[model samples]
Target: MTSAEASAELRFDPPGPGSYKQDPVHFPRAATRYWAETHPPAFARGTADFASTYGMLLGGLQTAYVNGIAYIVTLPAPEEEVPQRFQRAEEAMTGKLWREQLREWDEICKPESIARHRELQSIDPDALSDEELAGYLTRCRDHHSAMITQHMRFTASAVVPTGDFLAHVGDWTDLPPAELLGLMRGASPVSAGASAELERLIAALRQDTSAQALLASDDDPGDVLAALRDLDGDAGAAVSDYLDLVGNRLLDGFDICEPTALEMPDALLRAIRTAVDASDEADDVDARVAEVRDKVPAEHREQFDELLGEARLLYRLRDERGVFSDIWASGIMRRAALGAGRRLAAAGRIHEPEHIVDATLDEMCALLAGAASPSADELAARAAYRATHTAKDAPPTLGPPPPPPPDDSKLPPMVARLMRATGMALGALFGSSEAEHEEHLLRGLAASPGVYEGTARLVSGPAEFGRIVKGDVLVTVSTTEAFNILLPLLGGIVTDSGGLLSHSAIVAREYGIPGVVGTREGTTRIADGARVRVDGAAGEVTVLA
Candidate 1:
């Protein structure tokens, strides 16, 4: 989230109501929402409710990346009957009657709202007081019952890259250095179509499902190559350029597009703005806190430090991380979205990938539709909504971090059963039965097309940083925000996780380096030092030695 000042200044200033004559901005038509449908009333999906998605729709021109693949629990819903009114948020909670303990405040500070207080204080942080906490929790639980509806269907999604689908132009470096520097220097409009040819190439990928069909087909290599040869200029060029792009971005961290900004919903813009401002406030507080200490006794400083260390960690602005907040948060998000979209397209990905910015699953698709692209009014109108109501979009409070377990003698069987059951249930749902695929060298879904023979090194974490030598093909799990660490040393990349928009894929395209991803088990299946052939357009990896 932290970056250079150049990132914000390059944005296309938001024009008044209407200005551009190019094609209308596109937004997604179709929308997909993902929520866990559970059978047991006690089951909690945790933060899984916030998993993200991206896509677009425009009449018949549509694209989607819906719910990612995830484990599902398929047990039947309770047989008991329930009334429709109870289904809403409030009714279910009324059934449970709060006992006298629910009214108590002696523990810590009681949460303000009755429901919130019960929800949080119901748990004993220290297992040592399980009996006391359990008694109190039981009392609080009575005044609150959960709403459970029958499960009609259930599915979960993992955020796969859609390779390039969610990356920024700066991410893949699709735009050449001169243009990039121009935008960085405010010498060029963000919309400066520096490489119009690339736009066409990416457009072809958005329109062509033929690549998917061809790759999925049982046809021989001869047929595949023949079909590719017979394609139109755009398709053929897309194939070649896509392959080359992926290879370079993955290997070199170059982008195929100049930094461009996209539109952001008003709500998310405000949230980011608030977050940034709050961060700055936090920095100010920390500095003043020391000043406060200088006037205090030394003995109190140690106590103050300990207390502060244990205090809640809130938003802070220790650094100028979110520089956009002071000036144009909305513009920053828009540009970031545009940047993401540019790279995604370069990686041969479709959908309004720019929609990934602050989009819910439903809004995610809308951002992709040719007709659905938000107007500047819509994107900036969040300020309007706030004038009407105080809708809260911040994440729901995390009830509480678990309190430490006490000595064994204070433990109770009921507490142990609950804790162990929770772990077991979660493990059973998410655990994979497939054997771990092991390989030192793994091939990934190609983004840029190329064939290179290089040293292979597996990077599992920052600790493995030293192993990466120049020109080495770095292979590992999904290329995420952290991949930037290896950028200076890697020549190419291979990954077990992510599609084209993935960090690994886009970075490869930016660098014009070769990359392959979404291999699922590339890390476990490929061994180090193995010669490999990466076909980015076809998403294929062949082991040579």
Candidate 2:
């Protein structure tokens, strides 16, 4: 089908109340393209299957768009009457088995996946036979698909208990959303690892004046990495070790458009700077957390405590599952492409190694099988064409937008809790918000509280991440948990999509930075490098100069 026809076809209208709209970043082009062509049958095996959920179905539609096929999805309408099955699931959601499953997934399944990814990355694709390479790619794709399913389940399950608690407590007090969720701050393995690694690097850098000075200098990240590598002591070893821990993670969501952490040294350098320069200015969140917990009403205090405990327990899993799921899987896919692309580039089949992402899995397999591969020029042309087409504006929906969220007061208690739970699941799926506004000041959800003024560095995509410097106000579409590595560098953050539960919001609160999220078009409306004021308390970003 023609590009226009495909784009038009992709504008699917949801048939029911539980539907949501997702940003293109959620399902990146490279990964989506491969999935559409290679795993067509798996897209909708069954609603009852582990892989097929309302959220994943939406994501699958998004995948079709990236593949240049605009197929829309209509989810099966949920039973109007709450079912016994849902109650059973909800009861199990916060039980011992549920918690154990999450813990098992994190402690066992996640690390095993990471190890497998690293092993795959180390393979010499050139030495493999045609069948072996194909088998390897299949394994990577299958593991990635299964991981995505697991991620959705864990995330959705967590959302139920957390959201139900929040819904129950909404009118009980005037507590801010950030404080309620603050218990999740700095708890994820991703943030903890990044913080700890940075601390180690800081300790080493402090003792080496030469290395510290070089790091503080306005040198390019590549140059900085090179200079650090040349250092013959502890500073070099520290930098090397930090990268070893974080370098393999994906820069964004499952989208192939984003780069891995290893490719963006400048962002990494900025993170290091934040760690070294941190002062007493960091938020005393633990102390404040105690204060918030103490504020529970005498009547509902026990329930409040239990709810908070559940939310905190579940919150950490969100980022942990993300690390093991799409983020890690994307890196593996990137490695597979890069590995094959390198061999192809050496053999003069593709113009560059990165161009491998542009080819379909079948095309890649053909190239590996010693069959005719697309010429370098042909692949380059296809890349350019796809880039332009993908850049064309995507219609948010095929028909009327989903109905607005129901008024909170109108919902039944159980239904209200489920609605809140659904919102969390939707947030995990789309990462965009329904917030609307106008003018020079962009309004969004108040993610973190504070005020700051700095030059706006709009990272429209991962490619522009290098432009960000310490203390700059970061404007972007949205960020993922993987971005925690660089969160400390920004004085504030503004995102075009995602709500308070978003990666940008959660990390901003953790790091005590001002942040406004879900400003639908913040990246487009705010000019890059312009001075701006971020009033995270008021949920607005205003251009100052």
Candidate 3:
């Protein structure tokens, strides 16, 4: 196919579930290019292995997102025979398989891929010959595809068995699925590291008058980081290391459409400042886990112990999976596109470096090769179109939507368990919606369990993230893994999209903050700086002042 045809084809998603535009705060050209071309096909292909090893229920659909961020997949209810398949799959969830995957990732996949990404990140696109640049593009695609395969495989193995355990627990348990999962996941390395880093900075600033003065000033965060570095010791080193770790991370929900924490040092600095002053303590999550364990009846206690142990083992991987995933690879692609765009701009080929996002990878290759490609005017117009595009521009359902799952009452007890297990998985992936109202209280999925009241800070996108203050409630479209570093600064969290298992929910629970997720339009409906109360257990956020 021609480059344009190939680019258009990349936008195509199979007819199953509806795909919506995520990361609407900014126009996502490069991110869309990656998803449309790479992510989906790789994910779908990996699901084949999952289905072969697990059951049809676990393999019903790989994912449903077309070309945006945070899309979910839901499959039609299975026939009666499917439960037996699920049962066999549940039986195979032993420590053996999980261990093997972990071993492979540690021994082979992770180290190699990370090294490659770091190498690519260091390369100057302008220094490469056109062929070399094209070769980097190819490397980015291959590495991204490999990472997706690993993630999907690992996730498929983890989610299914965990779902089986939850199915065994039933919805009538003492804690909800998301909360229990959070407890199992514990404080992720990302969140805990962030909290500890801030604490370190705070402690250092207490002793260093010069550092304290830097904090008091209204200097840019990057400038603040620089000033801290000038202290020529741990404080500067701390800021430097933290920025390096978080810079290229997927901050606005797993897509390259938005900048990473490193790219926005000011926001990270503000979040650290907020965290230093906050009084929130880590919740006694272990005690909560013990309480839930005590709630299990004697008859099922043995099995519960087995499953819970395994769940906890696999749980920490939830956040870490993204760390090892292809987002780094995607970042490489984005950097290359931006670099190429800059060169093109210098040559008067494109109006700006960012307009490269509007072109396909092939078109970009062509531009780098001094071949025919989209004109600067065309790319600029495409960028303009993306900026104005909103989720409303997307059709609710693309093609015929998949049939809904059958009612719970119609199935046998084991089958019913399987259905509920899958339902919980799907629910956590796809957010719930409640009827809209004029009342100030907004309803959503109960993610983390707590109640918090604070001034609401509506952050529309990355640019507005610096506005968040200590004790402020964060209001946004959604967050990605990178925001884990800043979750401690918020009094509570609310989102326009995401299910209980969303990044927001998981991070809030880990940090012991109140959170209401999947409020379809929380960003639009909740006014910035309004006093709001988030009742996480009740899944509601009420604007009180």
Candidate 4:
């Protein structure tokens, strides 16, 4: 089909009122009915919580889906609350309230979220009866929704301090965000797929010769993984523990429609192999920190140190919030849906088990309960459309244009600080700088420093991950924090969307790999297996072949 014809076929009226911008940063692909239906309310609640906590003039964000693409718009806060919000913003700026929020995340939020995920994951959906499975799906959906909100609730705390550091450091020195963000390299271990469980697994595997032999065996990847998980003693226990932490988590996107690690055994096994073979490399963080600090104006050096400390302190939350909050929960929900789908497919009720993910929660429950509405054919069609279409097929925006930003000149000093810090951080988080490029070259944000030339592996989704070998450059639409699990296998990363503060950029910097993001056409311009040079410092990708 022609581009215009496809666009027309997919176009639909806006869900409600107000201007809406596509959120390709999070949902680059078309969402399934299950995610589209449950995401909005939870997202709105979470953003509202962040706004109230930071005293923003905006109430929270609202989402709507058109042709399965998610779009978002900000709601306005009540006029009467503006004064109170201003007061609170002032207090938040001066007090650095994110510190308290950080402590809460570590001591309360992170642990509690992990516990909840473990509890839900422990239940075997296959063991439950039809009625019991329906109830379990309901619980999964509810928890998934709550986790979405939880992920958003800490959004401000995660972004503000990092943005504050960027803003201040940018003024004090002429360095780009990519260089400054390198200071955050050691902060978020989660972004590098590091966990205590992983460390333990590595240690145990090193000592257990039999487990090592099994991992290195030529047996089917699935069988190797199963044997590893069931192996005897500390080695097996450690492998099981590590899988419990990561196996159920989505390997790519955030939605229930995305496949979990366990679902992609080959890639998961490869990643495990890579992790086992990986060794610690020398870190130049201190030298880089000192070099950047020396460049800052003498008068601002002390303040720069303070700002850098705070940014690093809160940087882990960037990935931790999403990874701990909804990513795991969404996978659990997918597992339950797949369980129901398996039974339905076996009974000849659905065309395919995976198609059940395209159904709404109620529809899924009904299907499990043997209802005939939303027939198998209808869901199959939905799945086909979602697979065929993406954010590229949808309009960049919908409804009226967004209002201009409020002038900070007349705002109170503290309120201005709040607005400036939050605005700068958020803008860098989502906005890309490069807009145009030459035919052989794709320009984007210089997300990570250095340069690398390698074969471009075009991966549209997790299913394509197996094509990526060690030192291959990953070219795709975008990547979420969950992609970190497989990042060790890549030489570099290039994306069509996302900015310097994006997960793709953050993980690349943490891994010390060259990364050019927001190229807008990297996937289209660079062919798979084509040798391409990625000059991340220059924000350019050149197709040499």
Candidate 5:
């Protein structure tokens, strides 16, 4: 069925009695039954954890899926907890609370999460018996849920300080968020796809003539990668180590339906090549920091320094939370599901193994246990529907219009400060201030500060990433932090969705590339391979050709 027909057939009712907004940033495409079941509760619980820890007025965010598209609503805290929340907010403004949370993330939360993911990743799902595989699926589902919650629990700690800096810094200078955010260039090494494994591999390749020759060979990309992984030396060991670290991680998106890095061998190989050949260049970060600092008034300059430092300290957590959490766990889940699908396909139970991803967890378990209630055709149809529908097919809002935000003016000063900081940060984090532009110009949020002209490569998903040559501008609906692994191929980034603080924007800034995000019609209006000029400082994309 067509997307419009599919939209008409599906119900758009609110899961509960509140306004629900579409979360296109995360779920721009339809979610599978597996993801629909696992993500909502985990998201709600995680948001609650962040809210309770930060003493926010809201209880948490609740999620609902309509026609497979994700929607979210915010819940309010109970009246009785107002006094306690005020006290917590006052303490939060002192910045001591988030600092402790940051320390916890670094010392405890991060290590435990990594350990759990490693344990799960080590298990070979294909080696398990039927019953053992069923149990393993359950375990993977549970772990994926926990990681989602873990990702959410740190949301406040990750964004609040950065938001606090933006809120305070905006008051002292007229610099746009794009310029101010440049100070965060070196803060998140992971956002630029930096890992110790990748560094070691690069070093090994640089020193080994044979490995470098193999990498430069005109052989099949997959065979090339396999040979590199099997090479008998430090270069080969480094290649294996790097693949073990990221091979199973999703190339884009959080859902299990998304393809992992190893699944896209050509793109992954190209990324490795880009990383190996990349030259280190000096960034004007220190100069930009000094310029922005001079704009801050004399008395608040010291406070400005403190806020900037805090923001930079916690900045890595924003992407790291998702990267180390559900992104890795979700890929593991996908691997198990695909393994099950392979068995089912071999038994002639399903038309294709990938169709298993569309099955609900219960259905997946039942199919594994030899129960055939859901026919293979049904799963195929579901997969087809999910693949065809995009976020544009769904309504932007479901149920009644949302209630206005509470007036912070009547609240205590500290409480108001807390609310403002959090609100401003999140608003800028996901919001775009683009206005309608002329036919040739696509307006958007000035995500990164630079100018570049290049061929626009319109990529709808990770599958098309192989078409991207180095220096091509990437035009997409949106990007997750996972896409940072491929940022080396792009000279600029233009997305149809996301704002200044979106992952596309963050990675572009960290990688020192031009980025114009939230250009509502970039992919549709700017033809693929069209020559385009991206003015990231002015937030405009001119279709030069």
Candidate 6:
């Protein structure tokens, strides 16, 4: 009431449709990030993908994930300066309470969290011995797992199929029959039959890029399909099986399928060798890309990216542009899609592999719109119509979050301990979904970068917060209203559970310290006083032994 005091800002609940207070599984950020799904990121652009290897392999995984869909009419277009707008709105509405809580959390959890981040980042991945590398990788994997396991929003954001995939679902049918087939092929599921079929087709791809490339260049993708159809009887069936396997996975891309660990998968290494062989025969890669580029329609030329994307999709599982990432995952998406489609056809349920990946939700409804299972050709037509005409769903708007949970000053000791543990535990285990057996940890992009060396105190639950040292890194999973008091004495922050916009990040920034938010398993993997370095810019942390 005094003139010296600033009037607290008013927080207004925005209108229309929005996501839950926060997603329970992924993307725990306060700001809305639905647009990040499926679409190319505004911040991280890349060269045009020429190989259907990974690019077109995209839409295969996007179609089935509903959570990636956002109601766009509610917010600014993706290209706008939305982050600043959100920050301002957030501050104004809650009297800057969220940021204020961030400051409070910073004062509570910073010191120790920051110390651990710096110590780990100082060590590099290359310098580690085999044992150290294994240990570090385990920590990384654990970091990823914790985020997925504890924070609902964190779990959703890191692994959701993506936004681009969601928008392009209706467009999958607009391409030529063969490219449609490739899309379906990429979406198929993996199976014993599909694997045998894939080997044969890949052998052909390894030997005959010229044959298919020639057809693609001439703008007659279906010609390539017809050629493929003429393969020796056994070989033809194998290819068909491969295409069907991919189709199934594409339709349900949101489902997680972690592959068993392998030093180098033969299927992928073969692709790289094939590319090298093709390029060696008189530098043909560029010429081939140009040939296909020229065939794209003048009016619809920009859409050529879809073709390139498909090419990249095939390559992503293996090549990764040139040098392979040691962390590359297995599982053949395109081949799997093809395999799934064949299975459906074998059961006499669908017509072909292409029909599934390219099947629009509307067309699927229309297919089922029939009293019984409709003919394959009829369903394909409806799908084609929807592909050319349907507009993608829009993103949901992000309004200001509700007022801060409560002040830290008045918190009881038990409540504060619980909140600290919740945040720390969630942060400690970020990525653990992809591996099999003892490979339980994962690595992820560290959003809030900082460094602080400290003794790591792993707290699996709330009861351990009482043992936190003033200079120690508080390792825990989730953070809530109660944990606010612990912030001031901490050196740095490491959470396995949240994103850049998560509570951990906000607090770290407020305290003017380094914060590696969304590490997932930071508490479990990084031991007490295990030196580490976290580079937010690089999205990695170096765990020093």
Per-candidate Cα lDDT values, in order, are 0.32, 0.65, 0.66, 0.90, 0.89, 0.34
Question: Compared with the true structure, what per-residue lDDT tens digits does model 4 show for residues 1-545?
Answer: 75446767755677788889998888889999998899999999999999989998789999988888989998888789999999999888889999999999999988998998999999998999999999999999999999999999999999999988988899888788877887888889999999999999989998999988998898998899999988899999999999999999999999888999999888888888888888889787999999999999899999988999999999999999999999999999999999999999999999999999999999989988889978989999999888877888888888888898778898888777778888888887788765689878888999888899999999999878878898999999989988888998989999988888899999998888899998888888999999999998889999999
lDDT of 3: 0.66
Q: What's the lDDT for candidate 2?
A: 0.65
Tell me the tens digit of each residue's lDDT in model 5 across 307-403: 9999999899989999988999999999999999999999999999999999988899999999986899999999989888988888989889888
What's model 2's lDDT at 171? 48
Q: Sort every candidate by lDDT, greatest first.
A: 4, 5, 3, 2, 6, 1
- The TM-score measured for candidate 5 stands at 0.98
Q: Candidate 1, which segments miss by more than 4 Å at Cα?
A: 1-444
The C-alpha stretches of model 2 lying farther than 4 A from their native spots are: 1-20, 28-32, 35-63, 66-74, 77-84, 93-97, 124-135, 174-179, 189-199, 208-238, 280-282, 290-296, 373-378, 389-392, 399-419, 424-438
Worst 10 residues of 4 by lDDT: 2-11
The clash number for model 5 is 0
Q: Candidate 2 or 6, higher TM-score?
A: 2
* Best of the two (3, 4) by TM-score: 4
Give the TM-score ranking, best first: 5, 4, 3, 2, 1, 6
Q: What is the TM-score of each candidate against the true structure?
A: 0.25, 0.82, 0.82, 0.98, 0.98, 0.24
How far does residue 177 in candidate 2 sit from its true spot (Å)? 3.5
Query: Candidate 3 has what TM-score?
Result: 0.82
TM-score of 4: 0.98
Model 3: per-residue Cα lDDT over 104-153, one tens digit each: 76688767877776777778778987788878876766777877776666
Tens digits of per-residue lDDT, candidate 6, 125-229, equal: 445543454454334333222221212211111111112222233244342221221222222112101234455665665556554453334344344444555
Clashing pairs in 4: none
| Regions of candidate 3 where Cα sits further than 4 Å from its true position | 1-31, 57-91, 94-96, 126-131, 171-175, 178-182, 185-187, 191-217, 226-238, 274-282, 404-422, 433-438
